[model samples]
Target: MEKTTSLISKKHYPILDGLRGVAAIMVVAFHIFEAHATSHLNQIINHGYLAVDFFFLLSGFVISYAYDDRWSKMTVTDFFKIRLIRLQPMVIMGMIIGAVCFYFQDSVLWPTIHEVPIWKMLVVMIIGFTLIPVSLSMDIRGWQEMHPLNGPGWSLFFEYIGNILYALFVRKFSNTALAILVFLSGCLLIHLAVTSPNGDVIGGWSLEPTQLHIGFSRLLFPFFGGLLLHRIVKLTTINNGFFWASLLTVIVLAMPRIGGSKHLWMNGLYDSLSIIIIFPLIVFLGASGEVTGKYSTKICKFLGDISYPIYITHYPLIYIYTGWAVGSKPSFQEALPFALLTLIGAILLAYTCLKLYDEPVRLWLKQKMLTYKPAFITVK
Candidate 1:
């Protein structure tokens, strides 16, 4: 059989790599100017973190968009192998990084600034490595714990679990669309809890005080939306799927007290639906390559590329960097610059891992374990 095309190289979809750049920036901006109280940009920046939803959706869409057709031909082993290689190395590296930082400071928050206990340090490190947030605890796994570092990293647990399930049952379902929509509805339910009484979105969705552990149910849909949107776009072409729908959703978002506000329960899902629409809209436009070349170029994509590492590192660091009055926290003015500096630093570090560590380590493992069939190499 012909060697199947690999997912790694630029030839498959150049636009998405560029698009990844966009996602990274939105995340970064959320920490920097967007969420910065000094700039008073919180209206967008606070909400801008929602772009992480776009990333999740985009991941889902891209995964299914790339491989859904080949599901029957792919093996369970190959599926898992590729995912492990793609995810685990970064997770390990992030944990190591978090551990080292926690050790340096001894405490990440001011109240906790007296010092982080060795036991709390171990638990925080464990969460970072495992990617699962502490569930039943009142404080959640990564934050409010004694040592607590890297709150953003918790989402990966769900990402990994969801991918595994998709490989097993959901990926090849005849009613894939229905399944995705249903999953989306579940996320909407979680969204309802996170909704403020005033109707503004919360920093993160968790009906149960903190969504870290069990929040997986809600996060599942962003991934599903991307996957579903991918299929919808393939069926419809760029003609209508991504761009138009995304715009519509955003407009709907601006006036929260309107159409969606009434249904009100699934506000998280309602707003996230806009993300699915917006991401494709950006992709479709970027595919043209005309806009960024002329304008909208300086910040968005640059921030997007580094966004993940920034997101992973920021929250946990907040305690370390700021805090004088017991969880009063640092205002965005003081925190924003430090956040950006740290964000840029993380991107450089994560790149080194992606290039020097991740690829080499993955290649070595794949060669050692897998059958080495070219068709099985999803990320060549």
Candidate 2:
């Protein structure tokens, strides 16, 4: 039941693309509600953290499908260059947005923002533009995030690691080896998720070791699981794929917290099962089908297009919204309007960056950085 595409003619998995957009929006909602709760136990979008895992999974699958076969013409350098071209522009824009909104986010959460010199903040933003994680001592905003200005850049940081790993080594592994790697990583992921103090896989932003552990645990499994899934996929047709797949994605993400604090492992079990089992199924179904009608096609295409921009760009606004929510202590009913505005603002901002900055930068990079062909055929 696997869908086939010729090596020359790349197939578009619009449903997967749309599912990614669904996950991205779910992340925005999760962040919007995240400020109200002190812990993962009470967050309204209880499983929203899983969206990162979903994203890693999706990236693995898409990367494998897109590049696994192109090693002949493409070198590791070429691949990295292309990836930076595709992703780094938005990374820079997200950081810039954070800086632009920095003064406005001066709240209890970042009480010392007024004290942080603009030159220092600019230095951090410049480092962030390179996607480098800074130490806590150098953390200007005091959130301990690798990229304080744009929190989600941590995921993109690990994403770059995944890309480097794939380029250097993982791509050379046999399917059996990849499966073994996936298995070991899955066991570690399950252990980390289940045994977490908060009963979730909701970390990896800081430079500290524990956060690094949480981050890698979250990264390795779904990402390698996705790589393995792509390797062993048996795609089957699904009717109305865009709707059903998107629905399933939202439901999995928006589910209530699985286990209460007393039973943290219960939620851990849920998180592990969702990551290990359910997400791959969703990905399979998404890949099995295509968008049919003009509207569905357009919806999927637009969603897919804006998904990355929105996910990367929206979180800085979340920092602002979360700060406001925490400081003002408004009821959900009262804050709904601002939350809605934040959501709309994020979308508009991402779309604007996409049109005005990201697209042009990537086009220029493709022309200048990625135009040269590899001189030697060195397929490992």
Predicted structure with the largest TM-score when compared to the true one: 2
* Alpha carbon lDDT at 149, candidate 2: 89
TM-score of each model, in listed order: 0.70, 0.94
lDDT comparing candidate 2 with the true structure: 0.85
Candidate 1 whole-model C-alpha lDDT, 0 to 1: 0.52
lDDT of 1 by residue, 1-380 (tens): 44443433322333354455544545554444433243322244335555555566656766775668765556777778777776777677676766665566543333232344667657757765766555434242333432245555646665676688778877866556546565665556345534644343333433245444334534566677556665655332344222343343234433323234354435554455455455556644433332234333333334333444445545544434433212335665766566767566656765665667766887788777565233432221
Tell me the lDDT of model 2 at 361. 91
Query: Which residues of candidate 1, in runs, are more than 4 Å off?
Result: 1-11, 33-44, 106-115, 135-147, 175-214, 235-270, 283-319, 322-340, 372-380
CA lDDT, every model vs. true structure: 0.52, 0.85
Candidate 2 Cα RMSD (Å): 4.9
TM-score of 1: 0.70
Q: lDDT by residue for model 2 over 1-380, one digit each (tens)?
A: 32222245567788887888889888999999988988777889889889999989988888888778778767787788878888999999999988877856667878455788888888889999999898898787777899988999999999888889888999999999999999999999999988888888889999999999999998898887888899889787788877877888899999998768789998888998899999998888888877789998898877887899999999889988988898899997999999999999988987899899988997788668765343222110
